[model samples]
Target chain A: MNAKIRALISEFGRLSVDVATLKNEADLYTAGLTSFASVQLMLGIEDAFDIEFPERMLNRRSFASIAAIEQAVSELLAEAGRDAEAA
Target chain B: MQTQEDYLAGLLEHGLLFSTGVDGLFGRSALFEATVDGLNALVTKHGDGFNAESVTYPPSMSRVDFEKSGYLKSFPGLAGSIHSFAGDDRAHRDLLADLEAKRDWSGRQKITDVVLTPAACYPLYPLAASRGQMPKEGLCFSLCSWCFRHEPSRDPARMQAFRQREYVRMGTAEQVVAFRASCIERGEAIVQLLELPYHLDVANDPFFGRAGKMMANNQRDQKLKFEMLIPITSDEHPTACLSFNYHQDHFGLAWGIKTADGEVAHTACVGFGMERITLALFRHHGFELANWPAGVRQALAL
Candidate 1:
């Protein structure tokens, strides 16, 4: 979990130096992650998790912070697991 | 060197401009018709195994669809939305008064579910996605769509509303790349046949925000987008006649378009600004179709 968080932070940090300065839960918009960058970050997250992100989850709120992305990822993974079990 | 003004003046004397303006809302005419014919002729001559299949799309698209495709996030400034009212007479009166006052009436307005499609490819994605999996070979579609842009300019190259002829293909990475490459080669051949001086150059889409900028840069470096530019008015600066775009797995993922193997498909598109190309032809050739080259005329079947 710590390693996951660090990986997330490192990706966010590449987007902005301010992300590294933040203690926790920094607003991504305030951290200088522009909309285009957010999409790139989402692509990165998708690659990292080896998961296809649904269209519904693509929005400013979902990408607002490292914590938010982690939470979304966890939810997606849980949903995927449920789907697998049902299958 | 002959100036654009000088050529336009000659065309005006030939009654080409007036005829174009009178016959069409968007300055279309007999000359324009002839130019389109010429283009078709050029396409047949140069396009490898050209099979012309035409499609006309609705002027508007579902706003929800665009939202799903992330268009709203990228091009909010360029997008135009439809609005309507569902209120009493007093509310209607208030809205009317706001309209009369030329104030911000958007607050009183409720946005409709649809928006005017800014380009032809916007609608094709949904159709392609619905198919689930594309064949290993490819799916090819031709569309002539009415497109709208919010920012209107007086330049003939830049119109508030225009027609676009686009060819879109979806398939495996190799197929998509091959499709774009073929389009580039054919586009250059067509330019040569038209006897127009042109150049093929790397181009970028105006992606929104900083992330979009980075993506644009990546696209540029990868040569994912290319434009065939020809001078219309001035010899110094040129207008883009055709554009070839390679969207590697982007639209495929967004729209759930997959290959036969269940992997995301690669997509590419060739867009021809019918009017801009017509304008270029007119600027290069002359107003009289009879005076044009016999080879060009025969190719157009004119």
Candidate 2:
């Protein structure tokens, strides 16, 4: 597994553990991924990625699942790379 | 299963001590004093090493100001108006006589171009806008303002008249998020320190109309708001004592809050209901200030 993906999963697992017991593929919502917790997750992701999540991407669908969160992070990283190169 | 009325009566009987005469809409001295002491303790402890400057605002705001910010357009239902007698005393008496006779007096009055601020932070946005660009990091302010609402509900929790203590920050998105998160943490800490049982949950502001429903949905989806609820009476449903909100770029775009680099600044606010929190404390600990826990009393320096 990619180190970034592993860290993300581990962090999500930790948060889920704090609220409820969860399997690796357990639905995050059922695992207590509340709206407030989603924000905390976003913050954690930002910290782990060292990138600022844009306002446009701060939405429920973006943080709905582990796969969605990973996709969002990849997009942000790609955008950051593009911006860096453009600069 | 005590009703809201029973809860309020219990507060009046055991918890509330009036420090000032109740001759007017204002001047509930006991409540005010307790509020000040509570806020002082909160700021001194959690807000240590932070400059705590205070701000007072006018009871009413210019209609044009609110209009410019889309408040009137958004919340016409909650807006309160100011009016003046356009005619002489004789005409006013005649109008009063007509009112006594069950006739309309609307034509005899002129609605003034002002409205009472529904919340403290409403006025600050314009001031922040006028200040131009925010510093790269941010600007933090504490505001206490007299706010009025037209909701006729007599619930003490839903007062038509109240005071709001607000802490506002304007800066980068990262700063705004961090600031809001810190407030949530500190709010939970303070509630626990006071030994007040509470729950943290997502909450939404009362938005105006159909558009408001959409706005609220967006706010919830974005995790723009969270509240700390402490039961004033029952544990099943609790009253909100503190709320933390992150206004991503909404107010920044509206009020022109900008970073030193000229980008729109993100904004966040932490609001403490001075009166409601006092009411909650009274509900939990009873009226005698002496009976409050030693640690709680010591923390408040009471």
Candidate 3:
């Protein structure tokens, strides 16, 4: 899961720093990821995880960092799993 | 040897755009009007067989609809609510006295039901909703309107009030996404036909605030918005001349725009900033249409 999220960030995040060198909690925007680039990153995460972000979760806190994103995606995946089980 | 300011000054001098000393408001001269009309016509002809329902709307729309559409959630700073003098004669007298004394008199005006339409596509969703369920094949609407934003600029391209021509698609996700892609292709082709060199790139709306930054980032990450940019005020930081946006059920769920199957509809819109395009044409092809390359002139039929 860590490797996949990191890879997605590197591929679509348009970050200035190398993904391998940075800590998970480092501020991506401060390090050079633009708002435009973060959007690209978010789409990549959605595709990789096969999750559609609900409007309630479309805020900045959802994509604030590698850690925050992982939490959001993990929670979403868990919810979807529960939904599928119920279905 | 020419700067953007020089180019803009040339526009004013040539009477292409009349400047009232305001940053984003201008009057179009006969030549400018002809060029805009021709360009709009050319675009319409390009999408000739889409069978899009053409709709023209006044610059203002119902404030209730505007608020319900979640416009304030995304762009509170940019929305302009209409206000008018809703006072009796005695209050009017005070207002006039205040105005004559050059004091604060705006208190007399009350907020009205209308807000300046921020985008050409604003009213379409509600109007479509009123018609009941969207068809299985979905709907496509061609719209033209005077849109307003509070951000004023001297760049001439970034006007506070400008006309936008848009084609909005509503349907299932597959249909709307496909429609958006086709429009991007069309936008690319149109700019080329106009002979304006541009770069197409993933883009985001200028959402406000710290939280808004995240929203923009998410939007960019999703690849939901793409803009065709041309160098106008600055070559290094080119301005967006056209924008293609996929709303992805944001409007559908809010306004209860549902497909025939009762699922939330997906939406996308391709917007052409008319004044900016007109400016870009003048900037790239020189102020006089006669001096523009023969092909460009022929395409616009100028």
Candidate 4:
């Protein structure tokens, strides 16, 4: 999940620094991830993980760091799995 | 002690503003216009030091450029698009009949190629981009325009059609940030000269919808915008009469503007709310300009 998130950040985050060198808790906005780029990253993450970010998850903190992104994706995937089971 | 309604009524009673039957729309009397002009001149006096190129735009801008600016994404509610009658005689007859019958005749109106200028600086970005790369020193512009927003309210300061006097800077991030800092100082100085009690605070645009909440939070987190507030209608809820914004390459990326060193340029602007400040002046210094403070009168040259 970390590697895939890093790959997505590399492709869409438009950060000034290398994603591989950064810590999971590194602030993406400080690394030059603009609001516009963050939206693109959100779209890329949704496409790659095959999960949609709910309206509640659409905020700065949710995309503030790699760890946060990973957590959000994990929770969304778990929520999707539970829905499938209920069906 | 006066409420917004009281202040608005005072303005009307004093012949400062004439009623136009619309809440946010009012015709300024000669005295009101003179005060507004004085405030505009004061802005120019402070901004002249920047040596900015002067540019003036019409009240409306190209719809295509407005869309590219992404204004709709954040402020769809505030945008105003121009529309006109484009149908044939038959449709015109129907429209007149609909209007005569008090039915909705607006459906016959077709959207035009222009939208009302959301901000004085909205048209400047693309023009600056068309001129090619920014100089190492960046570019600066002094602008004033009658801008529009759809919001209507009883607060006279929040006019639907209002003038914004602005100074825009574009270049490297350092250059733009420095420019913004200088404008902040200048903004404080101008208000002090006018002898109006004011405060500056971090602020955000009134972005529309649920998604906008996050966007507003992000903007505040990044400290991208600030406003200078002054008591107009009341002390508790002062009006934002001046604004400082740092766009952080948003305009550069959207307009394909670049710096001399081959990096995307950053942009910043400081806007003076002309009508709001004028209202503040009248509210604080009394309706009669002759009784205003000597220093304030000196600063405004009124």
Residue-level lDDT of model 3, residues B232-295, one tens digit each, is 7788878898999999877887789989899888999999998889888888888877789998
Q: How do all the candidates rank in terms of TM-score, highest first?
A: 4, 3, 1, 2
Task: Label model 4 with its docking quality class.
Answer: acceptable
lDDT leader: 4
What's the true lDDT of residue A50 in model 2? Answer: 80
lDDT of 1 by residue, B118-225 (tens): 888888888888877766566887777778777654455666666777888888889878888998988887777667789988988786765565556666766889
The collision pairs in model 1 are A36-B211, A36-B212, A37-B211
CAPRI-style class, candidate 2: incorrect
How much lDDT does candidate 2 score?
0.71
lDDT of each: 0.72, 0.71, 0.84, 0.90
Per-residue lDDT tens digits for candidate 3, residues A1-87, read 777888988898777789898787877766666544566677778787788777667766677778888778878888877442221
* Per-prediction TM-score: 0.72, 0.71, 0.79, 0.89
For B72-100, candidate 4 gives per-residue lDDT tens digits of 98899899999999999999999999999
Per candidate, chain B TM-score? 0.85, 0.88, 0.97, 0.98
Clashing pairs in model 2, backbone N/Cα/C closer than 3 A: none
- Recovery fraction of native interface contacts for candidate 2: 0.09
Better of 2 and 4 by DockQ: 4
DockQ of 3: 0.17
Residue-level lDDT tens digits of model 2 in B1-302: 45666765665565353312232133455654765667655754685533545667887888777777666655678778788788988998989998999998777888889889887888888888899887776788778777887765434565666667788888899987988888888888888877888888888778765445545566786678999998875667788888999977667877788888898888898888877787677677766777888987776767
